[model samples]
Structures are given as structure tokens and as C-alpha cells.
Target: MIRTGTEYRDSIRDGREVYVNGEKVRDVATHPMFKPLVDIRARIHDMAHDPATRDVMTVTQNGQTNAIGNALPYTQADWWAKRRATDTVLDAVGGIVTRVGDETVGEMWSLLDGAEALAAIDPQFAPNIKAHIAKVLQADPFHVSANTDPKGDRSKAPQDQDPDMLLHVVKETDAGIIVRGAKYETAAAYANQAFTKPTIANWGDAALSDYAVGFICDLGAPGLKFICRTGFATRAQAEDYPLSNRFDEVDTLVIFDNVLIPWENVLFYRHTQAAMHIRATLHRYSAFAFVQRSLKLADMLIGAALFNVRQTGLDKLQPVQEKLAQLAVWRESLNAHLTAAIVLGERSPAGLMMPNQSLLYAGRVLACGQLHEMMHIARDLCGGQISLTPDAASFRHPDTAPWLEKYYTINDEWGAEDRRKLLAFARDLLNSDYAGHRLSFQMFAQSPPFAHLSAVYRNFDWDGPLSLVKDAAGLSDRVLGAKTLTPGDSSLSKWFATETPKGKAAK
Candidate 1:
């Protein structure tokens, strides 16, 4: 079921209408704006078959192999494998690229978690979700999510404003439903399909609404247009903006113009409760992969800052070391949250393993909430030189080459060329337009800052802390109008079973 790199490339060449920077792209796999990310995605598929990486990139069950990222997580070890596979891909790519398959395939698993509720509301549509979940594993298509969570002008409803502002079911047919509206997606131009769904909105107790619809949208289907923001790849020399050229995941405003979602692909329709259920828990598993990117970003910060200080001998300064320590602290804080979430994992409503919700959400908050400040610290440690440095062309020019070489070369180990490349990298990672875009992307990629805080509020085990304080203060249960809360969190009870071998921790 696993696809080859070439197969992945051929799949996206299917005559999908794609435009970027006012030009219609004929081949996304080769277009300058998209080729880098497309090639990186292809490398991920190829890694699944490459002997050295296959063990980490794929899993086998019932004598069939599937991508590790596509397998449904059932145990802590499975999560570890998924984490490892994602890290392997990031390491291979040398820069962060969000919206690749691993980070998004989990959105389908969230639907699986809501299957019971979805079935209760609409029995006819529940089976479609389970089938698509299975299809993800067997077919191994590069999947992504489609939802900007567009908060339209609060004063006007969809009906008052443009009805097409929010993607809605225009009409249903014997074959399928035709959808109209648009979504901001990062990789729709090259991705195989998207788990299309409703953005966040007030359902207002409606039993049936046109806006309550979700589907498996074929990206190559008719009447779809991908209009992307201008890319950073060809704007400058790669040597001067390595990360930009190699890692820009082109975001697109995907216009779904009467696109058909075959009857079989419609996961839910005209069911507000089902839509609300999905909106509540959309990022349950996907957030782990999303936050993992911040962990890698932290690593990049530490490496870039540490190297910059070291090459300049500024590492000797106690003040400089403290700044580095702060970066390390933030980095390890992210690592600790991610690690603990896996070890303290919980079971989903569907009996699938979920990373400990509290720790995962908390990690997401920490990662996205303060990434800007961390980037600033890195920017400071990298020094003004990152911004003031001469371009690669200036360094290569005969007229200015001698001056840059004399000024940039620090030691025998740090040559003029190496110094120039390092400064360019630090600049791209911390100061370029792409840098700011990535910062904003992470902050709002999963949801807005308020949404991240809302998730933390919902997932944190408040009862455990409340019970601890109540016992300490000798408070009466009657005052709270509820039964006495237990000290142990019900979610973690299984993770913390009392029964165990001598001197061993419960799992």
C-alpha cells in the first residue's frame, strides 16, 4: 500500500488548476514556487522504502506495509514510532515544512473519535468516516486539512453577508453534494486530498444547516482552483536564503467552486451536532505533530545562536551564556512536555491512544505562545550582523570579496565562505520575511491563540488540583454543589495503576 516517490509525484500532476504570483502553474511538482516542498514530500515517501530509513518510516500488520505516519496509534510505542518518523523526515529536509502528510493525517483520526456521536446524529454518514480512515492506511495518499476557521465579520451572519464566505453545501445530488466557498490551505496544490470540513462557527442549536458539512475533498477534482501567495524560493539566491528556498510551504486560498464530493466521500451532512463535535476536538492528535515542529525550531535557534556566539568567541561572556541558557531552557521545556505527553498517554473515546491531553495542550501553549520571544532572543544572540551582512553576491564579487573575507573570517576553522553561509542562514531563520511568516503561521496554524488557550482550559485536569486545595482548606462539598472530586485524575488512573512489580513504575 505504500507509494513510491515517483508515484507520489505522478499523482499530483493530474491537471489540477494551480496558480501562484498571478501565473497559472502547469506542473506543481516542478514549479519553482512548489518544487522544493514537493521534492521534500517525495523524499518522505522514498524514505519509507529506503533500507536504512524503512524501519522508522513504515509499519507492517497482517503482512502488509504502510507509512508510519498513516498507522492509527494504539499504544505509547506507536506514538514513539510516529514521533521518530516525523523527526527523521525533518532531519532529512534540514528545515521545517508543515502540512506534509504526517502532521495532517491525524485529523482523520479525530473523526474516528467522534464516530459514535456522528452515528447518533446521522447513521448514514458515520460509516464513511471509518472507511476513509481505513483508506488513509491502505491508499497512503498525501493528505492535508482544509479549514481557515475564518471568523467572518462578527456583525453579519453568512446569510447577511456573502453566503459563500463560509464553505457550505450548495446542493445535494444523487452522485454527491456540490460545495461552494474557499479555505486557506498550505499544501493543497500538491497534496492528494484534504479532510475538508466546516470552520469554527456558532451552530446555534440548528438540527440541520447547510453549513454543517464535512468531506474527503479530492484536490484534483473538477472546479477547484489553488491561488497561492507568492513563494520565497526564487526571490533570491538559495545560498543567501537557504531556509526560504528549501522550506516554504506555499499557502493557497482554495476556491471550491461547485466541486463534487462523491456520496461515498461525504463524512457528514446537515448535522450541526456532528460539526460541533468535530470542531471541539479537531486537533487532538494533530497538535502533537504540529508542536513537534516548534521543538525542532527551538533546536534550530539553539544551534544557530550557539554557533554564532562560539565562532565570535562571545560564548565566553557570562551574559551571552545566560541568553543561551534561556534558549536551552525553552527548548528542554518543549521536549519535556512532548516526552511526558507520550509516556502519560490516554485512550481516546474510540479506544485509540492519545497523547496525554493535558501535557500535549500545555506543550502546544508553551510552544506557540512564546515562540516570538524565543525568536527574538535568538535574533539578539545572532547579533545585528545577520541583518547587516552583505549578500552572497557581494561576497563573491571581486570588488567587495577581499573586504568581506578580511572582516568575516574569524579563525582557521571559520573561513570567509562558512561565515557568510552561517550568517545567511541565521538571517533567514530569524529576520527575513519568510521568518515572520513562519512565526505567524505557527501561532495560528492549528487555531488562534485564544483557541490554544481554550484547549488548555478544556484538557487540563482541574479536578485533581481542586480536590487538593479543598482538602487543604477543609472546604465542604455542599458549597460547590457537586460530589467530592477525586484526587487522582480519571484520565491518568490507568496510566498510574497501583498494581506493579517490585520497584517498577506503572505504565
Candidate 2:
């Protein structure tokens, strides 16, 4: 069922223990650091009900309406609809905000893909995954992800060091399993729930280890304390740092002190095989949404740089246009990867449509690995003015207003106010401390760069290249193994042959 803005806001006021900057947060929904993003998330909910946006934000299923972002993708059309819905939210919000909900809910779908494997380990957990996937469609809770744990020592096992460093099962009762540890999660303080699970680690040969666990954690549950980092919103004026004020998704160190996880909520536990499977394929479906955000960021970078160059009539210069072209190349490269991934979508183990994993992961690497260089290009195009511009307050002051106006105003068409606003935006997007955090978020948000490359290595069809080289070099038959190796048959025609997906409600 779809929730309204008011209902979504009211749901999070569950008296969850939360703190920021050493101060106790009385109410997350109204807190200065969190309210902007909370309101943006609420707006996303309202979009599902608003008449003009409802068509784009929600879908009908079995005569019932559900959030488009929460629906399980079964066809290529489902993916397209999901993409459109996310774009609609970002466009409406006027800034990029990851971890809102859509970017994270797909992680559950990844788990669903391994239901059969999980059932082999524990039959009870298989059904739990399906139930939770359906629950997301029915309940539409604001979901986020929790994976990174603060490991005390890399050299020691979780049992040797402080066990709490990595979240572990402390005890099991008839009611549920009590867990203790912490996870670094974004937007956990204000979100309704998180798909809490183990971080990347070697599980050893043990079949059943305490660290092998995954569950749906209710954020408001007792004994969960949200210790969030100090937010950028309260640190600066909105006019000077607009993106930080409205779009900073405050990350939190959620302390799980003997928190109870109901049996029904446990997706998997004490099964290293299950844990390994999840760790391997956790981002299969979610990477699409994560990479999509980079596409949007690329657009922002292009727009800011192009506008800057054109404002000063620098677009006519050879060097400036070349820089602009370079930005376009990066932007379009991302667009190509996203569009191609959807066009050549592949079916998952569970029969759900997954974006072609190789292309999707390769796209992720290109978008993230080279983002800082592109930002530098944008920073160059925006010039020294972005860093030197005075704040809005300085422009409004009696003594300084005239001087800023005289220096900032280029022509009658470009007034002082517009120029100042543009500079402020460019500065925040590329030079502010918040900008550095965003860059880091892109680099490691989905996983580290090495992990992303590892996904590419695992998904890419290596045999195709190997066979091509073998055939060209006239290699012996034994090198081809038992089966004959053939070159891959991937092209535009193959993608075009795939059936088009129907609308969600129609399906």
C-alpha cells in the first residue's frame, strides 16, 4: 500500500533514541540536520498520491496500488518503470539524494535471487526472503541498507578481538535472537528500517558461524541507538551551501546493543554458504539505482560547467569548448552504459530481470573511478570566481553590497544576484567540504573500487576473449576444455529481439 506524506512523517516519530553532535535528538522528523532530507523523503511518498505525479510514482498490482520503487521487477518494462520513478523523484527534489529508499530496496531482491541456495542451507529462511519482498510491496516502509562494520582489527578474528566490533548473535531466546554491535548506515536515524547484514569478510570453512547473519532491523526497536555525524545543514547557511543543506543524507553509527531480531524478520543466520552467496550478489539489482545517481551527478557537473563558461563568453574559446566536450564524453559514456544495460538485461537465478551485470558493473567503475577527475574539469571550467565569491550575507550588507554588485554584475542580463547564486552553487558542488564527502560516498557507497572491479571480473564472459585469442593463435583442442569455446554473440540485434516489458499494473 502507498503511504501519504503525513503518514510517513508520523510513522518515524516512534521515540527512537537518536543523537547528533553529542546532543540528544528530541524528534528526528523536525531536527535541523535531518528535517530537510526527511521532508524530501516525505515528498517522495506524497508524489505517489499527488494526481499529476501518481501515474509516475506508483503502479497497480492485483487491483491494489503499490509504490513503483518497491515493486519487484519481473520484466524489462518493470525496470524502465523503476528507472522513471526514480528520475521523477530526483527531478522533483531538484538535488541528488541517495539512500532515500529506491536505491536500497533492490538489495532485498538480490537476496530473493538466492532463495533456492538459501533454502538448501535452511528451509525456513527461504520463505522469509519472499515474505519480506512482498512485505515491501505491501507496507512501503522507508528502507535503507546497513553493511559496513567497524572491525577493531583486521588481523584478528571477530571472536578474538572485541566481538561487538562485528555484530554477532549474543544469545537466542524463544522470541528472537539478541544481537550486539554497530553498523555505519546512511539515513538510519530517520528511516523506518534497514536491511542489516554482515560486511565483507572471510567466513572461513566453518559451516555455521555467528557472524553469518542477515535480517530486517526495525530502526525504532529498543536498544538501537543512532549516533550520527554532525550534519552540514546546521553548519552553514542554506543560501551559501544549498546542496548540503537540503541533500546531505546524514550517516549514522547505529549501535545495536543486545537488540532482538524476531524470527520472522531473520532472512538468514548461521550459514556461511548463505552469507557468501549474499555477499557475492548483494548489489546485482541495486547497482542500477546506484549508477543512475552518478548519471544525474554527471548532468549536474555538465550543467554547472557549461553555464559558467557561457556566462563569461568563454564557450567560444577552443580550450574551454574542449573541456566542455570532455565533460560531455564522460556524461554520455555513463548514459550509454545505463541505456545498454537495460537494453541487454539478463534474467536472474530467480527469474527476475537484472541489468546485464558486466555492463552495469563496468559502468559503475567508470562513473565512480573517474568522478574526481571530472569534478576537477568542472572546477576548472567554473574558474577562480567560484572560490572567491562572497557569501550572500556579504552581498546584502550596506557597505559591501555596492562593491559586490559592481564586481559581480557582468551585464544587465546577468545581474549580481544571479551571478552570486551561481558561484555559490558551483562552490558547494565542487569545493565545499560537503562536496568532498559526496565524492567519497560515490567511490565507496556501493562497495570499494576493488569490489566493483571484482564484480566485473566475475560477471564478464572471459571465455569469449580467451577463445578468440585461442582460435587466432591456433591453440590445441585441450585448452578449449571439454566443450568447444565460441565467440560471444552480443550485438544490438540480440538486444532488440528481447520482448518489451508491460506496464506494472497491466502485468
Candidate 3:
């Protein structure tokens, strides 16, 4: 049965062990910090039921319907079609939910599909993954994927890091394998059903035997503890903090205290090279989806920024118009890369059609830098109004009405109340913790701009261009090796050394 939003909520009502700040969260469904995020997740669930969105948000699985999301089967083009529908749902939500932090986990699951691709190499692994996917599809389960191992020193390998820093297999038994240590910055673990696949990013020869290990376990599984950080969301009231209220997706550090993963749930153990391959491939997929989402977000922000300019009567200002033009360029760049990726997508071995890695990586690099520029332009266009605007309560206050009406009212066309609401909406974006989080998110969304650029440079086909350049330079094997000078280069070099003029002659 396809779970509705209410059903998804009720499913979490059962007491599950989750710790936040040294205290166990008695109920995630009711917790103030978690509830709003759950509300967002519920909305996603509700989308599956909505007549308008249902077709796009749910998919039929083995004799059952599952919420179409990052986890939808993509083992074929038909699967890709379903995923495109899922993309439609995500785009409808805008950055309101999925582009938020926890949505990172959803994107991770899309990449996890690659693991299923790897399972095809071994029949034993294939069946285990298929079963897990089927079980999760039936319940519409949420999973948090941990890919980064906490290394005390950046230069050191996972094995060199305090074993407690990286999750490692400590004991193997007939029943399961015991893993200990912690994975850092795990988003949405508090509200998720399970955390799957803690794999090492980089490995060495000594680390080869323990290279990559992938498995799944429930959030309440014996030894897992969640340590959450206090953020803008956890500290503010819903009315006073609209941004935090709507979008405080919490990130946590999940410590596995000898957590046991049943043998059946173990997808890969000690296959280090395959593990790195999976991580890199997942990065490509997640980055592609993330860029797609970010472009949509940029579009929304651009609209809001333009609206702010028009609302404030600054639309005619040349400087403001120039800024808007720049924003349009940024938006176009983002969309172009996304469209390129889509058109150039290829079928993965796992049957999932994935975006071109080079384009996706390039898009992420552009987004990281361009988002900051766009935000700055938005702030500039809004001027001091974004920071100086009063809160929502001030508008409702009785005594301030006369003064607000006289001063805040800009054009006679827009009344005081209209102006106040516009300012409030703008403040909700500019002054809220959401703004701070967005800045942080954009800054660190990918590994790094340079890192992404490096990946793109590595993956791009430089050989084709190199061949063209070499041939143009008359350095190709056909000419250079045969000691023959190409006419173009030889003539150009000779002409450069000796300039001839009709009037000046030989001089």
C-alpha cells in the first residue's frame, strides 16, 4: 500500500530511540525541531496522494505503490522516466524542502542505486540489495547515507585515523558484523528509519583489505547514538523564527557503538577499490541532482529579487537593472549546464541513466561560485530594507499602526499592510537563519570549487583537444616525425620575423 502523509507520520509515532544533546528524543513526530521537517517530509508524502501530483510522486513497485522519490527504481529508461516524474515533484517543492539539508540524504539514496549496479557482479550481493530495496519500497523508508569517514588529519588515511573516528568492522559473526566509531555531519539521521553504507573516501594498500564496507541498520539498532548540534532552528520559536520553523533540517554525528548489521544487509565488505568507485559515482549522481535543484532555487531567488526591486519602485534604476541582467546571465548559465547534462546522459551499467559526469561537476562548480554572487546581488537590490525591516509582530501592534502607515507606505498604489507583508516575506528570506544556512550550504555543497574543477578536468576528454592542437601546430606524427614543416606554421613564423611593407620596402 502507498503510504499517505498521515500514515508516514503515524509510522514514526512508535517510540524509536534517538538522542539529541545527550537526551533521548521521546517522540520525533512531536518534537518541535523535528516536527517541521517531518511536516515537510509529510508534504512530500502527501504529494503522492494529491490528484495533481500523485502521478508524478508515486510509482508502482512489486504489486505495491511507493512514493516516487530519489529511491525510485532506475534500472531502465522506464525507471528514468519515473525518476523524471520524481524530479517534477522536487521542482514543485522548490528549495522549500528537498534543497534543504536533509534532502541531501534523499539525493544520496539516488546514488545508492549504483551499489545495486555493482551487485550485478556477484549474484549473492545482487539478491540482498534487491530484497532491501523491495522492503524499503513497501514501507517508503527514509535512509541516511554516510560516505565520509572522520579522519583526525586530512592527510591521513582512514586506518590511520583513530579507529573510533571511522566506522570499521570490528567483529564478524555468523549473525552479523559489528561496526564501531562515528560518521560526522550525517544529515537527517534523527528522523530517518535507517543509516546505510559508511564507506571510506580514499584508501591505501594497507587499507585495501578493509577498503570499503557497505551495510544497513535501523536508527534504533543497539549501539547507535545521535549527537545533534544546536542551530538556528532548535533555538527559535516558530512565530519569531519563520525561516527556522519551516526549514530547520538538523544534521548530526552518528556514533556506532559496535552496531550489528545482519549478514543479509551487508552489501560489500572489504572491497576497497569498489568502494571508492561507488563513492565517486555516487558523487556524480548526487551532484547532478543537486545542481538541478539549485538551478530551480536560483530561478526562484531571481524572481523574488526582481519582485523586491519592483515593489520598492527601484525597477527603473539603471544600476538595479544591470544587477538584474547579471542575475539573468547566472540563471541562464545554470540552466544551460543542467540541460546539457540531461541531453548527454548515458545508461549506467546498473541500467540507471545518469547525467554526464563532466557537465554535472562543472555545473556544481559554477553553482558554488555563482550562488554567492547572486545572493550578494539580491541583497544589493533590496538595499537597507532587508536588514531594517521590522518583525511581523510590529505590524500587528496597535500603537505602531499610525507611524507604520505614514512611513512604511511607499507608493499610494500599495497600502501599508501590503508593504508590511512584502517586507516580512523579504525579511523571512534575508534576515532569517535560513539565509545563514543557505550561505553555508552553497559554500560547502560540493567538496570544493577547485575539487570539482579538478574532477571535471580529470574526467573531460582532453585527448581530443590535444590532438587537434598538436595537428594545428604541425607537430603531428605525420608531419613532425617525418621532418616535414606544415605550410601554415612555417609561413606564419617567417612572416613574423620579417615584416614587409609596400612603402618602407626592405627597411
Residue-level lDDT of model 2, residues 1-507, one tens digit each, is 798888989999999999999999998999999999999999999999999999998989899899999988887788889889888899999989998899899999999888888898899878888899898889899999999999889887788888899988989998889999999999999999999889987666788889989999999999999999999997998999999899999999999999999999999998888888898899988999988999999999999998888888999999998998988999899988888787677879989888889899999999998899999999999999999988999999999999999998988788999998988999999999899999999899998899999999889877767777788899976897786775542333334454344322233
Comparing candidate 1 with candidate 2, which one achieves the higher lDDT?
2
- Model 1, 1-507: lDDT tens digits are 899989999999999999999899999999999999999989999999999999999999778899999999988889989989989899988989888888888889999999988888889988898899989999899999987735477576666677788899888899999999999998899999999888877656678889889999999999999999999999999999999999999999999899999999999998888888887899999999998989999999999999999998999999999999999999999999998888777789999899888899989999998899999999999999999998899998999999999999999999999999999999999999999999999988998889888998998877777776777788888755766785564555634575332212234
Ranking by lDDT: 2, 1, 3
Per-residue alpha-carbon lDDT of candidate 3 for residues 1-507, written as tens digits (9 for 90 to 100): 566668767776655556676577887777766776777777777777889988777666566666655454343343345447646755664444443322443333443566655665444564666666666666666555665555567587766767666678888898988888776543444444543554435566643454367776666576777777654565754454566666666767777888888988877777665565555555656675567667766776677788778877789999889999998888888778776565555456555566656776778888877777787787777667767866667767889877877887777787777766655555656656677777676666555556667778766655445455677775756633454443434322333445443311211
TM-scores of the candidates in the order shown: 0.97, 0.97, 0.83
Could you tell me the C-alpha RMSD of candidate 3 in Å? 9.5
Model 1: lDDT of residue 31: 98
Best by lDDT: 2
lDDT of 1: 0.89
User: What is the clash count of model 3?
Assistant: 0
- Name the 10 consecutive residues with the lowest summed lDDT in model 3: 498-507
- With a 3 Å backbone cut-off (N, CA, C), the pairs that clash in candidate 1 are none
